[model samples]
Target: MSKLPGNAGVTVLGDKSVEFYRDPVSFYGQRMDRHRGRVFLSRILNRPTVFVCSVRGARELLCEKSNIFQKDPTDLMTNMYGDTIVTTNGEEASLLRLSFSSLFTGNSLESTKGYVTRICEQHLKDLSSRGQCSYSVYKSLGTQLVLGLFLNVNPDEQPELYQEISCLCTQHWHGLISAPVNVKVPMWSSGFSTALEAREKLMAIIKDKLQNDKHGLVGTLGSLPLPDSSSASQHLLLFISALIPKALASLLTSFTLALSGNQQVETRRKAQTDADYLGFVLLEVQRLWPPFIGGRRIASQDCTIAGFHVPKDYGAVYISHAVHRDPEVFEDPDSFRPERWGERNAGQQHLLCSFGNGPRSCIGVKLTDAFLKEACMYLLQHYDWCVDPSTQALQYKWLPVSRPANSPTISFSRLDENPPGHSGS
Candidate 1:
């Protein structure tokens, strides 16, 4: 039993902790039922934990003095991702971040527009030919787009390797959701082994490109401020590996919305524009279904959050899904409304934690935005897509990332008229 802070009192939750661990969203909501502005200190994962259900408490934990609250990387993420930017903090995090930031400049993103557009068009053509597609769009298209932009490869060229990387990411999530507290899981060991293999393959590809001076998309990476040549390659590979999983996870969540018939017509119409509807849809999906249960930060010293006393060294879990759907912050918390993110509410923008906030916010956000926008716009513009009515109210399994439990079978038909700004193939 872990010791509680002087200011905090522990609430012993027996099997309730198991229920919360099993499904956090539903459990959190149920625990907060009929209680307004209450902070509960409950046991989770067999550890004494503070569960902040109020919006004010969550905001203070995440935004206010967030530096004191550090991210506690899980065993699975640490083993697979290691000390890469996603799981690292302090000076090392800053240095690696600075070196990688150079790769996402306005010019770099603009330069890759052609690659993004080309991939989008190609994917649309392939899907259209299939007539009925039930493939994991994240695995098939989203992974390729992010990998191409970051590492400069056509994933299809090395389908087996790409498939392995995708499987590793998926399995990493599986281990997290299913593994018990005491077990020395095989999934963790396997995930790490697979990650190393994928890294070697990626390095080989990068080295081949560098040796042959095959300036494909990697030409854009030349401007990055790596400390040395070796570090540059290492950083590039690690960053790509870390980014690919998050990118695909987010993309799959957005695809869930599309399969639910949320924005079929709009996605098709906006596929040709500089801004993609997938961008908007991703923002919406993230708002609806965030990847993580929010981010965790350990308190540096004693603090008060929404009236609850948080002592030094305590961990704070910011529930992003709860904050994103807060009735006070959003108009209708449960409804899917993409237009809320448009120019109309530009001034009254709600502080969404999907990309996080402050200095530690997501760096690959622009690349993610670009890829999603391009993919959604292309798919929506060229094809009419919807989930087969036979399986309409499908539920998504949320862990590691959100994805549909049932086969998301969507049908597509090529449009008779070309979408605006798009030149039909």
Candidate 2:
């Protein structure tokens, strides 16, 4: 097998985690160009890592050779979220997936549709009343939807409890990004320590819900065939965490910006009326701007990804942003062309890694898809929107959730309702 193109520099001194975290798009883009290849070697998190930026390599790493390139058990996710499906490996992971899959798919998912519709309408119907809206507003809406669906914590009905849990979730999420050290003193405490405290409080709340609330996902999850008593609570914490909401808000914001303004009025109109076209629009938005930069895996055995050798114990990361734009799979990669999904890239949704691919793909994908369509359709039906300043910087910051760095605001005008079901077309 051929050696990877780039260097896996020596240990901590050579670690490029800081640089990668700062601007991962540019970091990987520069190396991909320099190596003249999509798959290259680099040091990240103080490990000899192989960076996979091509669709072929990603497919091989995450799908075909997945057994050899496995999830890292010692991943930061484990410390923050506990021994949940996200960080487990082997049979344990498989079992957890089997049990939880039932909650997020099929009838369990269909039941959430009514709640999704009501939440979308409640949050989106008044966009024009405010004239302009920012990312935070959508994020709040996302948070409410997640908490309400997963924990039965409705913001409208139990505003106090919702706000408290929301604040705790934010604190808990901060630990995922902050230093791993956990320390506390009389006057000073690390973010990690505070996060741990928040986790305990959230866990208490979750445990109570699981015991008392005999309805919704929480109730059903409490009865699942899990390995241990704590499994249900741990997984509930993962679901109610701030991460999903941020991701939901990220895509919603990108969708708004992508089709905004008079120039794309026809496109917006088409998306509203044509469900397939709306799907294409959402797909394009994700392809160009994925919420998460990528996911990481470790080589369990010697393996080849897109013809590059990855030795056992080596780290492998797939950059969704880079993989989606691979010219071999996506023509005119950077441009937003919804038609491409219907034409050249037809039946190629499998190639995209926005929610990842293969067996380990995000479990909530179906639920996420349903919620996004409902939210987007609400916006399309209620108002016509455009970037408030039009010239505002729309550059994205990837880490912790991908949204514009400046949090661009958009102006919305209520569509005239002369005829029933008017679309302002």
Per-residue lDDT of model 1, residues 329-351, tens digit only? 67787877666777444433337
Show pairs that collide, candidate 1: 69-297, 70-297, 70-298, 267-380, 268-380, 268-381, 271-377
lDDT (10s digit) by residue, model 2, range 1-425? 89899998888989999999999999999998899999999999999999999999999988888778888888768988899888888889888999999999889999999999998888888887787888898899899888999899987789999999999999999999988889999999999899999999999999999999999998898779999999999999999999999999999999999988878888988998999999999999999999999999999988888988889999999999999999999999999999998999999988989888888889999999999999999888778889988889999999978999999889887876425554332
**Which 10 residues in a row give candidate 1 its minimum summed lDDT?**
1-10
Q: Pick the candidate with the highest TM-score.
A: 2
Off by over 4 Å in 2: 417-425
Best by lDDT: 2
Q: Where does candidate 1 stray beyond 4 Å? A: 1-18, 52-58, 73-75, 155-234, 242-282, 342-344, 347-350, 417-425
* Count of backbone clashes, every candidate in sequence: 7, 0
